[model samples]
Target: MDLDKVSFNGQIVDMTEDEDTMAVEAHVRALVLLEDALKKKEWLLLDREIEYEKSQELDPNCPFLHQQLVLNLFHKLQEVQLLKNGDSAGKTYVYPNPDSVNIFLGQSFWESKEYLEQWSRPGTLILAASQILGYRNVAGTLTASDIYAAFETWMNHNGIYKNGIYTCCGEALRDSVCKESSMSHSLLPYMNEFDETDLKKATLDILWDCQKKCLLVEHIEKPQALLAIPEFPIITTSLVQELIEKLKQVKFKCDTRADKIAYTDPRTRNIIYVGNHFWKQKDYLSCGSRLGTIILYVAQLLEHPHLFDGATKDITSETTVEHQGSNSPRSFQEPLNESIHNHDRDPPLPLKNSTPSNIGDALFNKSKSETYGKCKHTADTICAAFEKWMSHKGSYENESYTCCMETARHSVCNKSVMRSCLSELESRLKDFV
Candidate 1:
């Protein structure tokens, strides 16, 4: 009935009558106003819109607008999940707009990311102030110690982000953010969520620069070629190194450490790569040769159906269906190119049919010579022992069959000492045969 309710769900109301139609126009107007306020980071106005919309939302449209509103309120946390729509690929689509990737953060942080190329940014500085000092409101009054304490609380609240930075910049920005944290002295108890937004924002600032400017247009495709994303993980060394010099233009570090965010890094143990599988550790966690496998899969999807099961395999085979694009195993419609084994081969000639001089006799004779102890006899001494060993199995025995075992020496005897043991029984058997 009002401007707010209509914006969230004016479409759902039947506007057949004149009064309802007037309400619909106001609803549309309200949504446009809401969208503009969100862009301005105007939370008060945005909150008002949400309150008005939520009071009467009995349908899906209201929830849709509400979700967008909530995300706008927390957009700083969102720079990490690129291309999240149902295949439109969002802003991270690498092929056509490969140069268009953007990390959503403020300009100061963006400038800081650009500045880090030449030097390290004070992570501890932010940790102390934005997160640690807990004194952004009383900014000038907080002592350095209090700030450090607050930063630790912040870091504790977040995951292990001693240096929560990995922008599009090509270099590493880690110069040690602090001399130390309160974790050492206990001035402030650690908070687990102190890493609210600055580090991620700072990292994005660097990322936007590297993605658009630092990484040369030519080199960009190669790194983006790694298609598999294991756990919304961080950037790669190749990405870091290639753009580091360009990032120098922005002052960002290339491979500076950050928590795996998706999981704890075993190397850093900040829960980097935590729930992620071990198979993709090299490909996704860092840039490596295996990432080519991802592109190969895409090729499989488009070019070579025979190369993939299509139904069973993932965009990346090890990437579970739940994790990647797949929802479930597809019904295998057709056999993937008939199996080479299906036609079968000469049935391996049954072990029972194997000659006494070959695998069967070899296994039999070898066992007998060892069990019966040493016997410095002729080739038949070994042969007879092998035949005796095989005699238990009707399949292994035959009138023409011979024994298999032999001591280490060329002699077929079982008692041959280690010193006399010269070569493998099969090799030694050739001379006797």
Candidate 2:
């Protein structure tokens, strides 16, 4: 039986006598070695390049002195997930390390800079990269704690911490080398405590400086409160402004010779613009383009949910033309009962339990005096027409609701005469409906 194998590797060899006892004894020895390694902070026990030779003479009892024993427990080391990768090998845990944080920030900024600058939005990428480095806020927005956490995790992952305690000056380092004592492995004690707001501000300042260096990072808030992530699918007041700026840049302009006033995108036909001179043409497009759509969604997500509501033509041009043709109905009027006599004969008695002038009759009387011709009327006129149509069936009999058929101002009625008068009325009614 190889006692060396059982003792060093902490594995019990199958034996005829006292097998359980042997296993217990081996396990106890393995615990002692692990505790010793823990005290020295040599947690990278599974690293292939462990310094066995240097520690063998210096510390005869060091667990690493027996390389075979460490290798034998490779399965156990893997089970614990402490097997160090190339970059993490020989690293130490040092939370809140500034230099490590700076390195990560530098790398992330350069990687995401192009995409951010192309869309001119910066907040999102910075926030996502920070999260990847272990600084995360639950609300999907950047916060101070997230920044600090990211830095700390990056420093630890990169093995930037010292292994022993040190004074404010050089004395502690000298003692660590001479005595071979454990070092201060944590930077949390030395780190200056900062509130969430201050930490957030510091993070912003760092990003702001990156922006000034012509890096694509940007903060949209006026005072630079947060980084601008332009690709994020959310709506904000600032995002709306960015979209408007892009639209304005592509706004169509014509020379003096052009007679028809129209707005169109000169570069691309993706957007649709419609409106008159009194109203600025509202730009319309599917919110699918990465650069444009995200900003629109952002505007809706933020404070301007109504930003895209009125930008497009609700009714098609075909419908507008159909309503304006010669075949179009002259005016909207409620059907009168054929049984009721015309003005040439006396009227019949009111229906059972019905008044001489019911609500329907009163409403019809109000609508009879109004006209909806080629000219557009206010909402009030449309409302009056609807109220009468909704009420009295017989009230429009005597009232002439005819519109001007000629395409010019009527000589006697003094109303604009146009074949499109019926279409205008329909359009106004549809709008109200």
Candidate 3:
């Protein structure tokens, strides 16, 4: 099996193989299917037992194929592992990974002339990347409550006053809805005690309705003209500008404006009064209020349950296998592969055949042996390779230098920028070799 041919053998399994060759054939088929699945970004539904039936038919002595897939296969096969999930509750989620970041960066380059345009729309991957990278001042995992608070903050800062009481189009609609929410036209129905499940269901229903109504008010009417409204004064502050810049940097372009007193709901022309005082309170909550939606959007996009938490664990090959006769049948969790886990922060591990022999090997191959090489000249070569990859990806400026590094560090060795960098070095070494 030539590693080079592994690149293009999409349909390598032959159906005519005899029983003696069936086990090997089955293994090949599984690998091929798995690779194909990854290319399509379909992570789930790969563990179907039907795929293994052919091998069992051919060789009764064949070992039972593992149902679980490990992240190690990513390193061995040289593919980025973008997401991970299991059959366990709260465990099955797609979290951000380095490979996914690269794909997004690459996409930004492909989709827009200005990479920053990745932030032009709501819920872009760039927003998620910023949160994951801790570029924004946001300090914790995002949550639904955070999103609700953000909406409220936006409202409080922008609300118009009617008889000294702050109100906006959203509030008007919300008040009406809340009043009607009671089945008997009173709050009595909602005020009643209920079991945990029933209360949770009721709460979710109300929240969902509130969100729709908020959207409705926003759509109902254009905000009254700022010039015509005597109650609102034009705000002037550098902090507001700074806030906008921060939000833009993190890709959370909230609808906060200083020049405008109120904004019109694009759909219904309902005037929504949102003041510009949210920036007055200088705290993390202010930042969270501004960017909280983006953070939650990121979490939802990745299907991560812990909006404000870090990843559960690194998925590696050593810990991919499950023990037989275990009490846990619905899901499997292998022991952590200490070697791989510990070495994650280190440079890529050396392959048995690719150890560098000297400075020449280090220079030409850019193998792991050269990772410890303490010379500026070797460092120059690696930097040059990195620049080339960035150029190929249309990143001509150093603005994305940290982003690239973060993506590389998060990826498995084979699927990482280290591999790309090494491959770049090997190509350069071809003439020298």
Candidate 4:
């Protein structure tokens, strides 16, 4: 026999020099020819039993050869049935049993070393498959039954059954519908259940909302003016200002107002009564009433001090006091006693040659060398950077500011001038709010 010119299924076959390579190639060609015969509907011309016997005799160890023969036999049987019943049978034709096909394919293809190698790193691959193919109960060795179960679950989860068929609702619409349906009516009920981390997240969320709404400023006289979430109650302006003061001391580590006495002081009773009247028209004082709102708005201002940048400029322009000898505004000088008592008039402006007490003075008045001796930059540069930092909204990391070459947190000037500037800003915000 001429091995190079041997013919099988009407196609010429070329045999290679290596015996093992020739055998494998011959088996692969036979499988491909069988698939081509099935696709071309040449079942009547092919003898199923004879072909199966031939494949077995040729390569009994080749699972693919046996699988192809079995599939060819199945198609032949279906063709026989169809021809016997004519056109009517074609209308009622049934698909191959998926479970049976799965079992056959798993045994013949998936069990092969090539396919097994694909799943060697199965964690991410299996997870991605499960998202589209449904969850697998076992990860080690997947069976035909496991695949069938996964398909069934995936169909059920992603499709609606109608007219004896499953119609898939795509992932996008499903996600949007799920989001819309899952929204909670109120977060207040869960407040008590929140741990420290959860409370922090909730507080941050509320502060972010306030920041967006521009409600974190000094004044919020009416509860109705705040964000209208049912979970948060209305608050009085006095309580809002009080919370701002407390937060200033806590957040900025600035000096507290001299007049700000403790809650237990006899002086606080009148202040409490005045604050109560502000919210009494809306609702009476109760436990946790408007407390959450108070914390939220206060946190927003403390967390985002840059919100006051525009207002700071406006305050500076309105309070600028020029000296006779120079065009520049002098340091503001307001006695602590007068500032504490004066509530009806506009805040005093910076005056030349006056003693420094508030933020205005700290900004215009030059700091002594002793006060800022540890600083690498000059006093003027530090003061300029401090003003720039007030207007700056970005992160406050060390070496972030180009002017001072250091951050306020690390600067020695933070003790005197920086501290006073923060305190003055808070005081000014309180006057306006």
TM-score, per-candidate, Cα-based: 0.14, 0.14, 0.14, 0.15
In the range 264-376, model 1's lDDT, one tens digit per residue, is: 11111111111112233332211111222222222222211211121221233323221110112212211111211122111111111111222222212233243222211
**Prediction 1 global C-alpha lDDT:** 0.22
User: By lDDT, is 2 or 4 better?
Assistant: 4
lDDT per residue as tens, model 2, 237-256: 23224434443332112212
Q: What's each prediction's clash count?
A: 52, 23, 18, 2
Where model 4 places Cα greater than 4 Å from the true spot, the runs are 1-140, 155-394, 397-433
Question: Which predicted model would earn the best TM-score?
Answer: 4
> For residues 323-367, could you state the per-residue lDDT of candidate 3 as single tens digits?
001111111111111111121111111212111234342322223
* TM-score of candidate 2 on Cα atoms, chains taken together: 0.14
Model 4 lDDT per residue over 208-283, tens place: 4323333222332332322222111112233334444643332111112111111111111111111221122111
Task: Please list the residue runs of candidate 3 whose C-alpha ends up more than 4 Å from where it truly belongs after superposition.
Answer: 1-95, 98-108, 113-269, 274-433
The lDDT, on a scale of 0 to 1, for candidate 2 is 0.23
Model 1 stretches with alpha carbons more than 4 Å out: 1-148, 151-153, 156-433
- Each prediction's whole-model lDDT (CA): 0.22, 0.23, 0.23, 0.24
* Residue 232, model 1, lDDT: 16
